[model samples]
Target: MSKKNKDIEVRIEETNRTIKGTNYVINQLSIGKKLVGEVMTLGAKEHEAFLGDEDLGSYKSVDLAIEAILLQHNLHD
Candidate 1:
């Protein structure tokens, strides 16, 4: 595996799981071994995503949140 692939593999091994039909994740990101940020999805179609302890807010769809969050971080950078 490539270095990026290895990094992803190490972080994501058992963090993905499904209950009912909705997907929940306990995502942890790090640079090498140093801790970074974490995010989580809660609920079904209509849901909220959390960043650490902050509310990223609610969205009608994950796609919407994905676009909005990416744009948000891009602005920060």
Candidate 2:
């Protein structure tokens, strides 16, 4: 099932910065005013989700990552 952006307010911000020699595109995920998690760009259409310091695993798309975040956090509609 696909999640619709109806009841929840989701936000994704890209942190364009390179650490060491790797180009890190950290997308900060938030709900309302509270930060829920982050999605790190692994490659083209590949992303890794994290809640705080715990790795949530890799996803095929950003939407999948966000869905995982919502499910894990019990915030899905």
Best by TM-score: 2
List TM-scores for all candidates, in order: 0.43, 0.75
As a TM-score, model 1 comes out at 0.43
Candidate 2 lDDT over residue span 1-77, tens digit each: 99776887778888976878888888898889989888888888899999878789999998899788878877533
**lDDT (C-alpha) at residue 63 in model 2:** 84
Q: Give me the runs in candidate 1 sitting further than 4 Å from their true place.
A: 1-23, 26-39, 51-53
* Root-mean-square deviation (CA) per prediction: 8.1, 5.4
lDDT of 1 at 46: 61
Q: How well does candidate 1 score on lDDT at residue 11?
A: 36
